[model samples]
Target: MSAATATPARTAPGATTLPVADPAATRRYAWQVLRAHRGGVAAAAVVLLAGAFAGLVPVWLVGRMVDAVASDAAPSRLWWSAAALVVALVGATALAAVARLLVARTFEHALADLRERTVHAALHAPAAHVDGAGTGDLVARVSGDVDVLRTTVSRVLPAVCGAGATILLTVGGLAGLDWRFAVAVLAAVPLQVWGVRTFGRRAGPVFRAERAAAAERTSRVLEAVAAADTIRALGTAETHVHGVEEVSHRAIDRTVAGMRVSLVLTHRLHAAELVALGAVLVAGYGLVGAGAVTVGAATTAALLVHRLFDPVGILLSQVDDLQRAQAALARVVGVLSVPAPAGADAGGAGAEGAGSPAGHATTVPDDRAAATVDVRGVSFAYDPDRPVLHDVDLRVEAGEVVALVGASGAGKSTLARLVTGTVTPTAGTVLVEGEPAGGPRASAAVAAVTQEVHVFAGTLADDLRLARPDADDARLRAALALVGADWVDDLPEGLRTAVGAGGLPLAPDRAQQVALARLALTDARVVVLDEATAEAGSDAARTLDAAARRVLAGRTALVVVHRLDQAARADRIVLLDAGRVVAAGTHDELLAGCEPYARLWSAWHRGRTS
Candidate 1:
């Protein structure tokens, strides 16, 4: 069987092939996330310490009240002790509330900053890098994973810190008052700690699997929703639904398994606490009988042991939450680690000189744009051992229009990408002016409008401003008009009208118009239109073709024409067979000399006529 046929169907993005967690890696990721918010971490530490200190006051007050009662003090002393206890409890509660508020605020702000940074990193990454990563996974990292961090920093971590500190202080206080009772109260601590350590190791892997499953489920749901129309047309709605269900089921199973481990740990902790309480009671009674401790002291020890156990239980219970947060932190850190694309600033004497000729000035001119694009002995393969474009040699003059025409999958789009600085040739250099074309200036000089035009969520004015942020209203209108979008002015809000999702949805033709308008706004010296008008109907195509020709009146353009009529109007038509340019000349010259060109022209003409 062929390799493709032998392989099983692809699993959903974020699916885990193995359910093993690395505790060391998880700890490292958690530390990185915590360090990212130095200010928040500092605030959390301060809040936790203060809360722990406040919590200790109640235990101290309970001991003082017990001592007073056992001594059979006067009514005045007894009443004073009761009032002091009340005051301590009230003060502790107030301090805890303030600390909670401050910690929560700091954590939320830090999470917001991290989320923004991750998004910025993803946006600046190279297109090829982004294509390798799944959009759904990136989205989950920003939205869901960051949220988990917020919860951990704000709710779980502080509680764990405060509870642990409180337990330690309570134990110290008890030991100072009566050593035997204190020792008995902490006798089961070793067992409890051992159980926690054993289960904590398993918690990390189970939680990681659970998070991955949830991310896969989310990706599937998003795919199904986005392609609902295709699913309906292909009668594959049920299949997609089943895929979603499978992911959901796996997620539920992982979550339940993690929770089951957590429940066992909780039960063990509770049993340990009960055993410690029993030991404390037994030791307290024995000390009282031997006259080593007062009756009230023994009572106070039991009460204090019970109170300390609450925080201990709370600390143990939050281990699962901490594990989940660490898993999330790993995903977030992974996203932030993606390097951004390199580019040149608008600062060079040559670029400045070139700009001055056109009345366009920049603070810096890109030296790379001065280089010539030389694609000599170039070859490429998206997959190893399966070359697509091979040994291709092509060049264009400083001011020349080169139209590339070919059958489907002829590597035309890949060539355009090579020229636009999106991809580097595997075997040869793609130079811009003379330098290698892999920087911002080269990208700016060589602009491309692909078949799919992305319209961001914004007003019409906002969309136009993307091409030239400082462009005035007049410039925007002029560009729109140049793309034959004169009807834009007729909209109710004109330039202010919303244009993307949650706004007025533009038809495919109108979207193409917007893209062409953007190209005009860029005013780049070299423009590559890779089937930019493929989505437009025939009538709209003709109008757009005329606008395109007018827009390229004096500029260098590489037009990838699908229709022969459009190719006939280009300055030169270059026909490709396999990966090499087999014919290059005016349309009539190609039709007269090249059999492939003539057949393609005849077929396009018939299709257009029909």
Candidate 2:
């Protein structure tokens, strides 16, 4: 929860690690994703190998044709060899296309599986984890980084494999023709491989820095956009713009540096390749002149040498691509490595071992009725050194409403999160109907309505079904009615009306009502209303307050209210100050006994009347 627990160690100099898709884990996850396309992967590999073989056949045929011509072979044999060369070329081209299509399809299937898992993890990770991980970083991982991986897997890997196999085959063809020429041509490989390795190790870290810089720039840009209004209102637009500019400039500098390294490496390799080709040509001519090799054999060696180095050059050039992919993979693996939230076992013994306490049990007239909540000595913090709540103790009996009153940052919301199971306490425990609060099973008994109510882009019915996926139309309507969201029926499409993004935008009050409707649909026995009515106006607040009381009827409720008038209506009121409970009693009792409560009540009355 404390800033995503710091990113994994930086692999790039002067750049902090960005959570890109994890390469090792992504590769492993990709295989899992690819398991659904095992047949396609196999088929694609076969087609690719066949294409590579065909490509090699052309090189071999050309070498043979060269030998035939040099030896002044019969015209008929020459024509046949030329024809075979043409056929091999055509066959390889055709097979290459087929292999490409197969690989693309397989890659897409794998990408689908990865995207699904990433989205699932993002949604189901604990609130602390999600909140600590910025939205921009996650978006970049999902959209940008994932796309990079998909491209490499679909295009680069297959090409590297096919090209490499063809290059090897071509070299073998040269070797078969004349050993002396083959040896001369093969001498270039060790030099090229060594050069690639030297450049690759240096280039890998540079490319990684370039990628992290890009991610950092992206996160800053997103932050700027999200806070555009605030920045403008605060007269700090220049400051935000400057921050973005700095990040972007850093990214550009890193990218330029990476490219410069690649350019220098390429030039060095090109010089070596040119020298190798020149030596091959000179050696072949000398050997033919000395009668150590026939003219046809010399010509064959010349042609095959070019073929051999073509893939080598290509492989060396793509070292940059490989570096980028590897960096992206590391970022991805970092995210996947975050341990699953505590008490998240959905299978095996842990699920069966879950239990509750006896003190918090509530007798239900019906199985569908609500439960009590018990909190004892709960302490928590986003940072251990700065505790947000210390030894917070509170309880909500069945059918009782408790209101928490506090100034901003006084740990009211932190307590709500603890009770709702969005965050676990650093010490002590929370119990729902005597059950130890852990995981969704315990969370299912608690619902929290916070200041920000997210209305996902979907039909009204789609949004409502999030809380109760199995709920029928009647049940959905009932939940909506309970929250006074019956106005939904008046919309153009009723239950099917679009409600987010490009769809009809709901006023804040209406959005809060929709959230309450979701809470009503949930199986939660204890509802925590944290500033649920803060976004609504006086009239809307009155309507929402009425709806809340009706929907929460006979259910335990913890209301964190800013408006002390509202707190006065609760069956009991608890005052929190600097992360500790200062007082607890009925509103009248607090006014008579607690100075903080009396002062807060006076402020609320004055504000209401004013």
Badly placed stretches (over 4 Å) of model 1 are 1-40, 179-182, 344-372, 550-554, 574-584
lDDT of 1 at 227: 91
Error of 2 at 181 (Å): 3.9
Clashes of 2: 13
Clash statistics: count for each candidate: 11, 13
Error of 2 at 76 (Å): 4.6
- lDDT string, candidate 1, 1-610, tens digits: 0001111112434222211224454455446556776776677667666666666666666666777777877778767767877787787777667667766776677667768877875665444444434466667777888889888878886677778767877788788769887789878888798879988889878987788788778778888998999999999999999999998999999989998999989988988989999999999889989999877778778887888778988888888898788788766655555544455233111110011112245312322222235677777655445556878777776656778899988878777777766556667777666656656556556566776777768998888776667778998899888989988978889999998998888887788788778767664666678887764347887777877776666566677877777778787787777777687888889889999999998888788679
Cα RMSD (Å) per model? 6.2, 5.4
Runs of candidate 2 exceeding 4 Å displacement: 1-40, 71-79, 290-294, 345-366
Q: Write the per-residue lDDT of candidate 2 for residues 4-67, one digit (tens) a residue.
A: 2225444333323334443445566555656778899889889987887788776666667777
Q: How big is the positional error of residue 600 in model 1, measured in Å on the Cα after superposition?
A: 2.5
Tell me the whole-model lDDT of each prediction, alpha carbons only: 0.71, 0.73
